[model samples]
Target: MSGRFAPYGWSLVLHAVVVALLGVSLHAPAPRPQPAAAQAEAEPIQARAVDEAQVQAEVQRLRDEARRQQQQEEARRQQLRDEAQRAREVRQREEQRAAEVKRRAEEEQRQRAAAEQERKAKEAAEQKRLADLQKAAEEAEKKRIAEEKKARELEARRKQEEEARKKAAAEADLKAKMAEAQRQMEAEAQKRAQERARQNATLVQQYIADIRNKVERNWLRPATARPGMTCTVLVQQLPTGDVVNVRITRGSGDAVFDRSVEIAVHKATPLPPPPVPELWEREIEFIFEAR
Candidate 1:
């Protein structure tokens, strides 16, 4: 009744008042005889007067209720507007806070990005430094290896030179010893040759005599041969005392005697060896005489 229901109450009251007037009008008697009609009209006028006063009271109550309801509606509308304003202020504050948070987050992200970039740069520099160090170490290792190789080569060459010097010295000493031995051998050989010549002086004559006797035994006298026939024969022999060749250096006057003498020498195929190897000769000469 204080708000939306006030108008409804006013309408109900007005309707009730109309219904009472209608009933009164409907129940009133028809126009009566003059004296009775006047009395009935007077009673209806008094009843209408009472109904009009009630109607005025109801109208006043309706007016007062409408005013109260209007005031309450105005207050409700004012409260709604205040709540809406508060909501707007709160929304604005939230927007401001959100903007500030976003700005801070963007700043932090930028700082983190800068730090990450710096870290990557430092890592790259460190890697390059390590690579340089490794390269230097490799170069040092190569230098050390080269130095060791050079030292080894020098040592090997020194050993080879030492060995060569020793070999040359040994060869020189051997040559000197061989020269001394050769001189001694030559001296001994000359001494032995003189001794052999002295010893073979008589043996050589006997060897010739033995060869003449052998030829005489093998000879066949020719019919034309004569006493006093004398010839010097040259004979060639081998180391085994085998006759290799024969010739008459001096011949007898008769051809038959000369041929017979040459045949006799040939018939003595193998003669005799010398008593000493030094006395052996490849050639021998002898005189043949027919007595």
Candidate 2:
């Protein structure tokens, strides 16, 4: 029995030492001891139980914070994706706007070029029309000049022909007038010659009167005498008679002169001019002188 009791005591002592060491290590910052008065005021709790409850609460708080952080990271990622999509849309819209502007510029250039070509073509047509009109006017002027020249030539020829006809008519009229004047002069000369022959017959009668006056100078017969004496004589013969009688028709009016005149007459029987055969008696009377 002693030996058993001794072993048991030693075991107890060892166990006690182990329990004290575990308690100190397990609860390093132990709860402070309550005052004697306070100890009686409330029921005492196990230190280990309080400690286990505090540790469980801390662990749960940590898990809740980690879950919140994971939710924030996911939200940020979704926002970044949305921003990138919007940027892509903006870039495509800007490219389309630039293309539209370029197309409008090209269309305007084409319109301006077409308008310029129309203007130039209109100017060219106007110039050609004016040139054609001017050419027509010049041709008309040339035709007028040619007609005038031909008219002048025709007029000159007509004038020349008229002058030639007039000259020929004047020359013929002059020749006819000259022939009429020459005929008139010849007729006048022939009339004058006939008048002169009548005058010559009167001279023969004067010669015979002078012979009868001289033969009756002494005979005073019944005859007439002026201061400038005048006389007449007659002679006759029968068909078979040899002698003819002489008679005086004019004398100085002396009776004795008549006898002397008879003797003188007998001396000059048959006077200077013989008697005409057609007249049996030839008689002559004369004006002895002119006053």
Candidate 3:
């Protein structure tokens, strides 16, 4: 029992000492030994026993109060630890959220940069295509102009050649007409000359016949004249066809017959006139005969 209470032995001893001092102060004076002295002494001893029991009970109550206070301090320390752990967890979650936001912002910036570059490239390609089309159109226009110029030149040359050919043909036709006209004029002159000659011949024959008939009608047949007697006579006449002279070119051997033929030609005066003036002869000879 002493070993079990050894941990609180000093506290129990101090309590017992305090209780003994209080009992001494509260005790009455001892009575003188007499017939009632034993009873008084016995009461003092019981009172001392009661006081010791009360001291023991008070020490036990003090020890129970100290134990309760220590348990309440331990509970407060556990609650503080739990609060600190919860605060640390909240700080870590906030830092993670900040990092995620920064990463998303950086990705969006990269996408914007790529889109800008693609837009510039597309614009440059469109400009180049428009320039190529303009160049092609200019070349086509130049070619068309050159072809038109060449065609116009060809047409002009063809027209010139056609005009030259027509001029030459006209000249050839005029020359042919002039040559034919010249030939026709020469043939007409020859035909007129032949007609005049024939007309002159006929007029001369008619005049000779008229002279013979007139001389025969006027001739008086001389007795010395015979049928074989013939002579040539020449006569001259005025524009009025009157005979002016008569000569015998060849006379017959009989002089009387020649004179008779001469006298007959003179008596036949005023010979027949020619039909055309071109047929009139200033001198003429005729044969005279008595037949």
Best by TM-score: 1
**lDDT per residue as tens, model 1, 30-122:** 655558757767777778768667766665665566566556666766776787888888988888888888888888888889889889998
Candidate 2 lDDT tens digits, 131-230: 7778888888888888888888878777777777777667666666666666665566555645543444444444455455545553444333234444
Model 1: colliding residue pairs:
none
lDDT of each: 0.79, 0.54, 0.73
TM-scores for all candidates: the values are: 0.36, 0.30, 0.36
**Which ten contiguous residues of candidate 3 have the minimum total lDDT?**
65-74
The order by descending lDDT is 1, 3, 2
> In model 2, how large is the Cα lDDT of residue 71?
50
lDDT of 3 by residue, 157-221 (tens): 77877777777777777776776677677667667666776766676777877887888898888
Please give the lDDT score for candidate 1. 0.79
